[model samples]
Target chain A: MIVSIEKCHHCGACVGSCPKNAIFLNDLVLVFSDECNRCGRCVKLCPVGAITMEAKK
Target chain B: MRKIEKDIVVVGAGPAGSMTAKHAAKKGARVLMIEKRQEIGSPVRCAEGISKHWVEEVGITVNNKWVAREVRGAKIKSPSGHTFLVDEKNAGNEVGWVVDRVLFDKALAADAARAGTEIMVKTSATSLIWENGKIAGVRAQTYGEPIEIRAKCVVGADGYESQVGRWAGIDTSLKADDIDTCYQYRLTGIDYDPDYCEFTLGSAAPGGYVWIFPKDEDTANVGIGVQLSKVKHPADPKMYLDKFIAKRPGLKKGQPLEAVAGAVSICAPLDSVSMDNLVLVGDAARMIDPITGGGISIGCIAGMCAGKVLAKGVKANDLSMNTLQEYETMWRDRLENKQWRNWMAKEKLTTLSDETLDKIVHTFSQYGVEKLSVQDLLAVIKRHHPELVKEFEELI
Candidate 1:
């Protein structure tokens, strides 16, 4: 998942919904690690839609 | 890396973290609380409304420094504008106060400091340290400097996205059905009444409700929460809230001072909040009320319960799940029924159509609520719409 920093609220909502526990809020920055399975749950749970799929390679 | 040692290390300096640290420290346990933020209560992520009764119960002395408005009651409005007024005088619940969240959080942290908790700001827990096949301490960073914290017990008071609990192998994850994504704006020049907090139900907020919590006569925190499963588009909560504000003549001219976004979990009480040397408190433990989307009071109460057991475990030199089970028992005895029952009620409320919402509110408006509970609501509907009680009876 890719987080649009400008739109991100840093609210940590995505961090909780990530089934793999791949996301963590680093102060204002939202980090998505390799552990993320691209479940797309965080994209939907994000209040401002800050997170989105990184477009399948 | 510098090494710090303590009996307990609480991650996240929110109300829950402060309460746990305070209670445990007062009991003679050396406690340390770490916060990622430079300030204790910066980046407000809550509705800032807390019921008054739990404050005294948990031994929090109210100070005018944090209170913004003391409300007598709440105004629950249906989609069609039908109103059910419930105040402290009649309702089984106590009245509440709208607070300046930043100040309230700081005051709580200050109180914990007074009780002898060592607080470190701009210090973040990066991961948990495991030693000898058991829970040990935390790996943290102080500013840019890496530091290691060695503790006998770890307390996860982190909020909705509690990483500590997950790292401890606890399932604190929320599915779309259990979480509500929220968006809020601190608006000025509104028609909101300061004496009563307002909540509008129905399609305006899909699975959740739109709330107007006043800061004063001219300003208020206007927000909306929607079930994640019900969100069909990007920024659905903000969309719904803006639509509601546009339709309201009273709020049409309101101007926003700040925008805040958050999420609330309205799930059933977790299967466990403690194990071995680790304990979870507050939102990290899914203590939020399902029907109200409120967690401040509930979190504080659980923090106290967890604190007592946390200290005892340290003193006894037993941080095993066996010793920490006292915390689980205390919280379950006090809060299990309410959280479980409200989760059921929320499920029923979410499936309700706007028309049914109008009916429920209209019926409730006639008598007003004596107590806020699923059973009480079903009883009232049983007296009026006998058929309505059937759908809800299955919940009980």
Candidate 2:
């Protein structure tokens, strides 16, 4: 999952929605950690539609 | 990184952070408040409704600058459209002012600045600075520049998903049921009663409610809060709100002026809000009202409590957990029991079926029970419908 900083409002909805607690907001930046398994919980939870999932390369 | 020092550092410039900074600075402590947003309250996420009494309790006067409208009461509409009105005097903190949140928040930050607190906008606390296993300061970035600030005490007023609390090893995680995903629109050209705020309950908003808080005779904030856990399928809150508005002719004709979206934590207060030299205030401590999802007043009060305790700790040269724990005890004494009761009430509300909700509203209206208390509601049920009273017996 990738969080576009420009679209993100820093509301922290995605942080609380991540089941693995992998998504965190440090200062104003939303960081997706290695613990994320591409679960799309945050993608749906984001209010501004800032989070998106990408296939692993 | 530019190094700065202060007696107290408060993260976030919302009501809680600004109030904490204001009180602490007034006590002869050097306070600095940091906000990540360029403007203090640019994006308004709330319904903008607050009780008048609490505003006064925080020593903030009610004025035309921020108050959009003064409401006389609140009307609760059940799923069946049966309504009951509760007067403002009896409603207590349930209803009062439909405010301009942008102005209100900016005013609060200005008040803090006037009280000798230095405020930095567009600054975000990236992480906490720990010394000997206690929080000593914060590492943050101002705009694009890095800055390190050290303080005797750190107050985390950083809203719902507080990273400061997370960094300090506080479990800020909430269950899906305890969080409300909300969407709101400031609408005009609506014929709504400006004197009262209206709340609609039941399946229309599963596990939560919808509200119409009027800013004027023709302008209002139309919003809905749906419990994330209660949403059985993948859905957007906006879709539900749109469907709801489409059903009402008056609202369907309304034009959207502004749109706001956010999530609110609607759970009981955290187990502990203070550890070592750090203390959490407002939404960081989960002090929001579980039933109404209102936090402004409670947050301000908690911030004042935190500011007082932190100032005393600095004066005593002790920023230990023991000293900061005073804030925990003080806020608990003032707000804990009420918050816990509200959470319990919210639990009971979520389990209610739509038919049951209609029956409850019908009962309240029939009995002319304008002022609602947990005990009164239970008594009304017991007198009119004995079977239903058993289900709510625990609440009383």
Candidate 3:
């Protein structure tokens, strides 16, 4: 998932809903690593709608 | 190894999945829906804003219990703070409502259940079952144990990252450039009319826009979206939102009640949504509207379409790639052209600088172009900014 620091609101919704714990409010934005399962729970739980699914073409 | 049988298996319990189950049940078909989440709509996404007309078109019953607020118009704010009120005359009759999405989604699922569709929560479909080159059923894990469910047909109503569709051998990947990153908040104790939704355009959000949808006189859902490809400075949306909120006299003092963030696809592909014994709906098929980032309406529509087509296939005792192709045609005929055009428009609009946007907003305001449809607005731009007009003309 693409976590844009500028677009994050630190809602914590994404952090709570990520099945694989791929998101966290490190500074302000939820940061994810290559370990993400791409389950999309974080993307769906976010009220502000900031995180997007990113996969290699 | 446990085996169960059903007429149809629907993966996911979002709007598309529920609607697919509902319509199939209405046709007297036995439908089973599996949702990975324990509760429907608990982890809320989306602004919960939808046009009233789409509900009416789908023959859904509207009630206050699920509606957060009703709106009759929209206001557009340029990056420089110039505002344009899209009067009711141009906003269309069904400007719509900001909904309690959790409630609305639950109600839709409830409606499907009441119509005889069986729902199983906390279950995930792990893979698709194929026999002799045709889909036969799905291998699912429910409550942490492996279980097999056989079905005549399977409907993939799963969202953007649809594993079921992927397992079914349908290509569902979205290009990084085709997606949007968005953020939203439910603010209470805000002072604003509950009758209008507000949109802020231009530099506030690159390649996207910001919206304030009122849930009540003191509460609203406000957020912003920007294209994934255009993040130059790459400022987090929250920082920009804070600045915007700090500047907005109406919202600066409002207390934020709840904050949520998520993503939605703008250019979801539908060409490969169907294959043998399986069809994809909603974000799995990438059926979202490219311009507005709205998918609930389109997802529901796709669900209903998939349901109808799947039912016909089952009744005819044929759920092959050929039969399911009917759904592909139907949805494409209905939405593909428009969505493709909207995607083009989105691309063109995203390329504009904030200054150009301000000029467009100013010119539109001066011409009272809020009264015109988006197509008409393009014509106005065509007249004055002919060079820019070419971009939009091609989109149309």
Per-model TM-score on C-alpha atoms: 0.98, 0.94, 0.86
Which lDDT value does model 2 have at B289? Answer: 94
Clashing pairs in 2: none
2 or 3: which has the higher TM-score?
2
Model 2 residue B209 lDDT score: 91
Which regions in candidate 3 have their CA more than 4 angstroms from the true location? A1-57, B232-235, B370-372
Model 3 C-alpha lDDT per residue in residues B1-396, reported as the tens digit of each score: 888899899998989999988988888788999997788876787888888767866657898999988888788888887777776677675377888988998999998899899999988887888888879888888888899989999988767656676677666555546766667678777777778888888878777889999898888988887665554433355556777788877788888777665566788455678877888888778788787888888888878888888888778888887788888887788778778877877777888888888878877777776444558778777777777687677644
| Whole-model alpha-carbon lDDT for candidate 3 | 0.77
lDDT of 1 by residue, B312-359 (tens): 888998989889999999999999989998898898899999999899
- Model 3 lDDT, residue B271, Cα: 64
> Which segments of candidate 2 are over 4 A away from where they belong?
A2-10, A19-21, A24-31, A47-57, B92-94
Q: Give the interface RMSD of each candidate.
A: 1.0, 2.8, 7.2
**Total residue pair clashes for candidate 3:** 20
Candidate 1 at residue B384, lDDT? Answer: 90
**Which segments of model 1 are wrong by more than 4 Å?**
B394-396
Q: B263 in model 1: Cα distance from truth in Å?
A: 0.9
- Give the best candidate by TM-score: 1
For every prediction, compared with the true complex, DockQ reads: 0.76, 0.37, 0.15
